[model samples]
Target: MLNHYSLWKYLIVILVFTTGVIYTLPSLYGDNPTIYITQYITEENHQTLDNILLSQIKKILENETITHKSISLQTNKILIQFFCEKDQLKAYQKLLTIFINKYQIFLCTTPAAPYWLSVIKAKPIKLGLDLCGGIYFVIHVNTEVILNKLQEQYIDTVKATLFEKKIPYIKIYKIKNHGIEINFKNSNYRNKSIIPLSKINHGLVIHRIEDNKLHIIFSEIKKHEICERAVQQNSTILYHRIHQLGITEPLVQRHGIDRIIIELPGIQDIKKVKKILSTTASLEFRLVNSAISDFDINNNLIPEDSEIKLTNNGYLVPLYKQIILSGNYIVNSNTSLDEYNRPQVNITLDKIGSTIISNFTKNNIGKTIATLFVEYKDSGKKDSKGHPLLIKHEKIINIATIQSQLGNSFRIVGISNLNEARHLSLLLRMGTLITPVHIEEERIIGPMLGKKNITQGFTACTLGILTSICFMVLWYRYFGLIASIALIANLILMISTMSIIPGMVLTMPSIAGIILTLSVAIDANVLINERIKEELKQGKPVQYAIYTGYRKAFTSIVDANITTIITSIILYLIGTGPIKGFAITTIIGVGTSMFTSIIGTRAVVNLVYGKKNVNKLSI
Candidate 1:
């Protein structure tokens, strides 16, 4: 008589499949419509919005009779989650118009996992951007501009040190060799000033040259530091800016020394993206003077300390070099319609800027103040000599006369449209970029295409599994039917195992991995069956062949799966995005297949064939 599995072995199998069933519960519940209300919520708004939004949502739900699974008021966000897509869409369409400048509403999809399951930290596999709709951008920052700006800032420091130390110099200017050249009255003045310059930090090197000139240069180490810092700070700015645009979990990564890679999942609006990402905004408030003598428009400018700026209205205004206030002092910005029904930007300054602006306007009541707009873009124009330049082009976006003394709050009138007003407001809130950037690569993935891909991938997986099941049953007969049952068990265990793993993404390539796993699952079954046939042909008893077959096949199965597992580990470590997805699923599926193909199929064999004393074998 054949031996049945021991109680402990039966208990182990039961425990594993039970755990698999529990984990599989999450995948059974499909995705639901999700609404996210993300905004830069201040403490005052946080307390006020709780009750206001709750009441508003109540009224909206009462009118529409739409019920939501949960309404979570998180920090900096409000999430209205529902199991039904129609209800989610209806609430989104109704509530989005109300937030306005207060918040941004985005429609998304999330699994309708139960509260208890979520409490246990269980979640279904996340879909990748390649499988979900999204946009990709490769942005290249102009490190030259960053370096040039840093040099100019340091030049001011150098000038200050000379004045503070009372070192006499004739003239100082930036040189083409990434250094500043300072000319003294004589070599004695330059040599005497060298001691003071030696006290300077900020990675500046001062060297004396011929003709009473001293050169201040940045070392190679400092240049490398500048490049690294430029990328890091810009990445932080882009992350903040994207979140402000209502995107969750966006990937803003550093590619090279001056390049950045950005991925926004579930975003399809290219225009909105351009407005948020492409605009390089900087604000400057300067006094426009009546010093026409200061400007020789034919010669490009008039004074060293002042420059002639052309306004949008075709008027040339000479602005002082000193900026009274910049975007750094801004506290908030909002878009609204003016008394003339034209789009306008209402800006609020910080406490310091408020005091400064109030005093400046009071002293220059009849004077004209200009708001200089600095933008970074490739204007698609060549230089006079046919060379191209991507630079920060500064012009006067708005120029208004000071009728009376104004305070921290002011309006920017004459915006072309409401869209312009909104875009400007967003830029001001996000702050200005340290340097200009260009979008070197752009791609858009529509939601429709994403859905099509999902359908095709899922259909292909289903067809593949069915074909394998049919072939297994036809060739192996009773044993094949048993193998097919284990195949089903293998799939359930694979999905459940994958779902439990943290941060696993189910992508298109991952489907291929799944199908490949199923094929590999049959290989194990084939090994066990062929070994059993060989033992039976050698005149061994059915019971001995059954036991011996498994003993011999186990080694081969271990060796084959071990190699595959190692390859998958390598792939996961080195791959990106979809490739990582494939590797993760493959690794998990291989482990699950090993168990189901050996232990699971053998348990069935023991329960059916092991309990009898028949000499005939099914295979």
Candidate 2:
């Protein structure tokens, strides 16, 4: 019942809507390639690194004024764009390395820039470990140890408070299954202690006294809280560590209540990363023995703690602070080569801890302080002294006067390599330099796998579209062939859409989106084909069937696609990354398909059937 003219009209509409081809020429030759580079960073080095990248980009743009340029910056991300010629891709790649290599930048290249335009805005390409192999790590978390540490803090606090209140009780220690046991000499104090102890809630579940001892049981709710805290602590630790390591786009997130995820792209030094992540940089400060001379203090009086044992070099080997400031007061820290070309940590203090630090420095201004012992985690390698050592210690105090002069901020001078200095900064930032904690879990992906996966995925997608078109035309006749053409157009439009959108990444998931769009475009043709068959069966005139079929089917077509549009919107809003790409393409495809099926397809059909007489159903 459909006419040749009407069918031609629908075909054109579909082609225009889906392909953005406008004509056949642009469809094949419009594509071009480009490359991007991401630079590594530390709190201390990001500014210098960013400036270098910006300067290089500015120089390039000065020579060539590329239209449709864009730039954006966030807390830890940067994006830029320009129209690029395919031949210039190699030059761009070299320019990126030359400008950003010193800042530890990683490079990425794409045959097309899809993340700059609005129609099909591509996201920033996420470089997986397989395609851009980087620092791979496996951190085994000591959860039991972390929980015990948490419990210990609460117990210590309660003990200190009871002592201050003169509420004398026998020794208190942690019991099995996460409870505290107190040996009280007086029954009266034991009953009174329960009410006072109820206030000590550091994520602990306090149970009533059982079997002549106080039983503490951490319920599921409490356990979950503890796990969450551990994850937060782990995330913070990894963030600080990666920040210090100067890895850009470091993915650090909570995996489960008990685990964490950290991905540092482009970090190839496994040993260095392992060493930095493994070391617990515990920093402590203790008052000097004013009674002894600097020489005597250095020569004798060993620290009791095994982690801070003294050495035999006529100077105290290692000593920890008895009671000094914690590293949490350090809001920011960075590493730099000193005047002597040795690595040093330059730290900045937050306001809450500044008062204490300012007062400490003011009081110790002119004093020739004795050995301020420093400890370093041995890299598990042999030292020059040929000892099977676990840790290293230094008792030098050349910087005590320097520390006193810096007010709230201070510097730790004298370290071997840039890696060591960075490690020191990570330790301080992770809060392990002030406390004790260990890595819980880790995973790493390399660039090779990413490239393989992406290539295979794209190949499969192309094959799928070709096969789909072959089947559609073979099964549905002339109308099916028209639909297939439109579907191809739809794909071009989607690609071009992405090229125009900023921050859009043409990832593996986005290929899936293109397939979804193809389905939607074909579905519109199916609707029209079915409508034409119904009119033909009803014995309507060819021209009447053609007009009526499209007019009557128009409402259903619009309604169906509109409902799908709403769903796609919701999906786009809630989904992350890949899912969002699918939703965007699907929604756009549906809208475009509807117009082409109703209008363009009708025109083509009318043109074909306008003067024909004895019509046999072909579409």
Q: How does model 1 fare in lDDT?
A: 0.78
lDDT of 2 by residue, 6-98 (tens): 445556665555445432223233223223333333223333335555666656656564432454333333444345543344445555556
Cα lDDT over the full model 2: 0.56
Off by over 4 Å in 2: 1-124, 127-138, 207-220, 236-253, 262-269, 272-279, 282-329, 335-344, 349-423, 426-452, 471-482, 489-521, 532-619
lDDT of 2 at 481: 78
The lDDT values for all models are 0.78, 0.56
- What local lDDT score does residue 605 receive in model 2, on the 0 to 100 scale? 65
Candidate 2 at residue 503, lDDT? Answer: 36
**Which ranges of candidate 1 are over 4 A from the true structure?**
1-16, 40-48, 64-72, 82-91, 96-102, 141-146, 152-172, 175-226, 232-249, 268-444, 500-503, 565-576, 599-616
Compared with the true structure, what per-residue lDDT tens digits does model 1 show for residues 1-619? 4446887887898899888877777777866767777643211121223757876777887788889887877754677788776897788778856664555567776677786878876676666677777888988876778788777766766777888888888888999757899999998888888877877765778888996999998888988898888778777777777876556657787887788988876766555565567667788898886665533666675654567887767677788766778886776898888878998999999899899999988998888888998776666875573433676667787878899988889998876677666766767888667677777789987767877888898788788788888987888778888888888888889888888776566778898899888878889999998998899999998888988988899999999999999999999888876787789889888999999899988888888877678689778
TM-score of each: 0.65, 0.58
403: Cα error in model 2, Å: 11
Superposition TM-score, candidate 2 onto the true structure: 0.58
